[model samples]
Target: MLTPVLIVLGSYFIGGVPVAYLTGWLLRGVDIRRYGSGNVGASNVWQSISRAAVVPVGLAEIGQGLLGIVIAKAVDQGLAVQVLAGLAALAGHNWSPFLRLTGGRGVGHAIGFLLILSWPGLGAFVGLSLLGVALRAIPQFVGLGIAVAPLAALAKGQSLEIVAGSAGMAALIIAKRLLGNRLALPPGADPRRVLLNRLLYDRDTHEREAWVRRGQDE
Candidate 1:
């Protein structure tokens, strides 16, 4: 219906706002996309900018996703709004016009979408994501956690639209990373190093975080 279309489109535009890019530019006068991981997401902002600002940035993105769900709920009762919003947020995070189209991996944005679509779904995603990051915070697990969203939805009796939409968003996340010129490890790269990078990603200092970014940038 027109409602779904409009909700999705609205979510896309809202998600497309590029809070990180705008925030960094306003606060630091530098486009964060050019400084670290070439991403305009919260993680990059945390690395190159002030860590205190990450919460506000993440909250703003989450708010955008919640807004999408509200619009969708007004129209109908399925996962249509949530799913579309998730995808739109993903699209926005990856191809934000504000950042000259350069942006981050959209993990947070995707999480934002799920949080609004289904709280249970959001819980599942958060637990899995944190577990993955705790054990090994590889970007791949972030993608994998996204892939888990549909399954989580199923566990909660969610509709096909939600399932497929969430899965598609996950796929988009993987595709974005691969297409964005991020480094793919050589077949022979040390497994320990890979694991270490994943586990340590969430806690490294700004200066040392650059090491992780270098691996991704290469």
Candidate 2:
């Protein structure tokens, strides 16, 4: 029990190392938070720095999870250790340390977790990722794949660890796409874009819906 708690906290601290922030600052002398997607994740690091920087950024994401497993295994190796490690990895990705306590959306880190914790879940993740890419190519279905993945996992009778991890991953992905509802041209914002962002990013979905209703009534 104590081991699991430590794994979660330690993984978060490790995850919070903010490799992307350091890389962006060293190469470009710019905070990644100020540019592109305003995220201290690998994608923003890649955007702020050179394209080649993604290599290290990607490694950092994977390393966080690897570190978690190492810590967990030092105490014990079982399903609980893996689950706790995955959760820690996600927390670290979202709330990193070196960059004023901020970070990315955790997909890279989540992928690392799945690879170590459950190969079958990793397989499902890969399939969903491919389908997501294809569905998003149409632009309209940009985030539908995220919602679809959990349903697929539920149908498969996935283990609780995999299901919870998948749900967490799905939530992060959907929330991320929602926050990035930027407009290339701004005569007027696209309603579909606005609605999708609202639906996906709304942490309190019912509340957001109620707010929308009030505005519509007014």
Candidate 3:
């Protein structure tokens, strides 16, 4: 009993490492949260810092998710515990105590968890998400890909645990997208529209360039 509890807690700390935040500070001596998109995720790292930086930070974030499952598996815990650990990791990455409950969008962490939970689902998500990027309609396609993950797992006849785990991961990602990085809506802005934009575009505004470039001059 104690072992499982420790495993879950360890997974959360692992996922809470804040690799992107450290990367930005190390490379440019700036808080990543104050820069591009104000997100402590790899995409923001890419926009705020260098493409090269994203490689390591992205891999590390994914590894955080992967390690959570690995730790649970290492202890020979059952599937439920493993799924719980994975979800814990996602929760940590999404709302790290180290960052005052602020963190990334959990896309990378979700990828990591799904990779171990169901490769077919992960493949479906990655393929479709990439397709969306290629089509210049990232939010729509990414959301579609996430939405399809559990279905893909179900189609492949994965266990109920795997399907449910995949769905849980999707829920985390969607929730983060909706909540954003704790940025407040502009004064007088329609709360509903801003939330819609966050869900659909991962930003407060529809203009990608403007959103990404915000706070750059500061």
Top lDDT model: 3
Write the residue-wise lDDT of candidate 2 on 36-111 in tens digits. 5455677666555668989878887878866787667766766666667766776766766555445776667766
Give the per-residue lDDT digits (tens) of candidate 3, residues 1-218.
44888988988988988999999889989988888788899999999887988888899999999897897888789898898888889899989979998998888888898888889898999999999989999878888888899999999999999899889888988898889887877668898999999888888887799788777788
Q: Please give the CA lDDT of all the candidate structures.
A: 0.68, 0.62, 0.87
Query: Model 3: residues >4 Å from true position, as ranges?
Result: none
> Against the true structure, whose TM-score is highest?
3
TM-score of 1: 0.76
Which is the winner by TM-score between candidate 1 and candidate 3?
3
User: TM-scores across all candidates?
Assistant: 0.76, 0.70, 0.96
What does the lDDT read for residue 197 in candidate 1? 43
RMSD of each: 5.4, 8.5, 1.3
Per-residue lDDT for 110-176 in model 1, tens only? 7777776656567777777788778765554565666777788888887788777777877776666
Candidates 1 and 2: which is better by lDDT? 1
By TM-score, is 2 or 3 better?
Answer: 3
